[model samples]
Target: MAKSPFRWIGRLTKPVLIACVIGFFSAFGLADRIAGFSANLGEKDRMVRWSAVLSGATRDAIPVTLIDIDPSTMAALGHPQSAPREVLAGLLSLAAAKHASGIFLDMDTSRPGSPAGDAALAAVLAAYPPDAPPLALARRLGAADQAGNTINALAEQASVLDAAVRGKPNVIWAASVSRIDEDRVVRRWQLSHTTCAPGPGATLPSPQLFAAAVASAHPRPLSDLNAFADSRTQTACAPGTAAASPPAWPRNPDQRAAIAFLIPDGPDLAAPQFITRDGRRVPLFRRMPARALMSASGAVVSPQAVADDLLRDRFVIIGASHAESLDGHLTPIGFLPGALIVANAVATAPAVLSGQPVGPLGATLIALALLGALVAITSRLRPLAAALAVAVAVLAALMALGRIFAPSTASDIVLAALGMVAFLSTIEGIHAIGKDWRARGWRALLKPEKPPAAQPTETIT
Candidate 1:
């Protein structure tokens, strides 16, 4: 009897269908979490260039600036963890004089230092004119969530500077924290202090917000700070909508804002030019050594020049950027200083407002479509051939998409394709097993052993 044409397909159907269902569910469930991790996998160098290229690498400088308390400054000052409070005060004083839009110190002033230094810094902080840019000092916040906490209680949760500096009205305290992923990479920026329970007359602002507060400072009040605090939008802004308004603050204190990193245009980061891994040119904000803020004689550098080059109307972030600071992190663009991380977060505000980061919906749909095509193709082609073809096509597609979309979304698509591959491969293995079993049975049934045995016995008799 001839075998039914549908027999082979029937054998493959159950396993294939079962695998597809599992694949779909798993892809939807874990793709966003696990697959999105270790983005470059071990290809940090290449991925860095790729990430920069996709971020629309540019040659123009951004408005932000980095005043790093880097190695050079450290060598001059003879301290590791702290820069002279007097020096910091001098920097701030100069920034104020230059008409800076915002000045943020990514330093921990939680403890009191030299009294004179502290007093000088405090004096500078208090002396800023109403028209001058705001100065925000970074403070570390405790991990305990304050979701239902009281006013006084929430205040206690903040690990702020000593009473002297923390008491100033001109200085805003922005929490400096990064939502680190399992891979130890910072992919999200927490915008609210929701975790620190809500209380009356108490608000928690992120360091990013403090920096922005300075950038957005004008003679006129924008609105009650609290009103805008919890209303940040995570979705991309609509077309032609002005990003002019201060960035939306998330209502959920734990909400994480997506970070769209700027690409590097050069290898020697300290140099003026930035370069992507692919040799493409990109622009970055002006970065002056923290040493530049002061002269070799420990005097403040050209206040006017500093103002024109870095401070005037530009958002300034001061932090430790050199390697010894140990603040470097693994980014899509390889290891970078924490200063750049803050800069990236600040820069992301405009990008998000401009709707540059594509959402996951479109990428998810594309992933699903590709998965379905893989399933259909595997059903018809030789199993091995199908696997190879699908893998090649999917990887290529993902690479192309990674160039256009964010890494997070690209990961989702790749993850979905991987799930489909697992499903299809399993079904093929089962079909092959059944095919071999049937082949063996047919060979046995068609064997001529019995006739041969009978003839041998008769001849012997």
Candidate 2:
């Protein structure tokens, strides 16, 4: 008797089912830990980093700059740990006069400074006109800075943060807390946060809000903080404008505004210069020493001269970038100061708002489709041919995904391809072995009976 040709199909049943399960889990992020377990295959975080890095520089220069509180600036200011409050006040005053789009000071003023200096800073901030470009002040978030009253309170504390804005109603207090990923890297960004405060409206916004506000002030509206924060897309301008309106984003109150790091880290972990659209080689965000913004006496440069050279409508972020300052955070572009991180975050607003961020759904569907196609193709070939063909095909698919899609999506495609291969191989292996087993069973079933012959022989004896 001949073996049933359908036996191979039965053998493939179990492996096919297992493969489907694996594919489903991988698609939904359930298999992330397992996939990440193998370094060569599991680099989800690195992929995320790569996606941002490959995003490349913007078509136009982002109108943002950073003022690093470097060693020289510290020496010039006659302060080691912190710049005097008066010096900062002078910076702010000059920036306001220069008509800067926004000024973000990334410092914790929770502790009181010299009484006279604090007063002078407050006076300068108060004297600014209501229509002055918005100023965002920062307060370091700690475990104590929760919803209820704690040590980080605004009232009980004689804080410079509060003193800096004593009579300045226009200044917005932005929480400087950053969300660190499980891998200890700052990838996601928070657009806004509600910090408990002492004022009538006792809530402080996130520094991202200030950045968005600055972006909104672009000659051509590039971003809308309120709409962007709420995850709603809004029309930014009329037809035929140079800027495109940002797409509507889904609202997430927890504020997981993921950072889009434009710069890529080199072998030295330093950001290398890239040629810009204008043919100039420059880093993503240019860093200027704080002293450059001031004079020999630590006074801010005259508004006319400063505007002519720098700070004319540019969004400026002032933060300590000195290595000992330890104000830097781990990012995809390597260890960078929070100020640069903030600038990168701001830089991505245009693209994110335009809804150009990578899409995983499309990639996932494509991978699954390719998996089906692979199964069909391999089923017709011999086992050896199937393995070689599938391997080559999966490699091709993985390359296409990595080059054409976001890194995360490409990784997903890779996992899907793995699942497809596992499924197909298991089926083929089982089919090959089952063919022999089925043949043996058929031979046993068809073998002629010897009982009759044995009975005749016994009778003759």
Which candidate comes out best when scored by lDDT? 2
User: What's the true lDDT of residue 327 in model 1?
Assistant: 75
Predict model 1's lDDT versus the native: 0.58
Q: How accurate locally is residue 86 in candidate 1, as Cα lDDT from 0 to 100? A: 81
Please give, for residues 252-361, the per-residue lDDT of candidate 2 as tens digits: 22245556676432234454444342344434455678898788877877777664335655677777876656787887657877777877776655434333344457
Q: Taking the tens digit of each residue's C-alpha lDDT, what string does model 1 give over 311-353? A: 6656777777655667777765556787778887664343222
Judged by whole-model lDDT over C-alpha atoms, candidate 2 comes out at 0.61
Model 1 TM-score on a 0 to 1 scale? 0.61
Each candidate's clash count: 13, 3
Q: Estimate each model's TM-score.
A: 0.61, 0.60
TM-score for candidate 2, residues paired by index: 0.60
Alpha-carbon runs more than 4 Å astray in model 2 = 1-46, 53-61, 144-170, 195-203, 216-254, 263-284, 307-309, 356-461
Give the range where candidate 2 is weakest over 10 consecutive residues by summed lDDT.
230-239
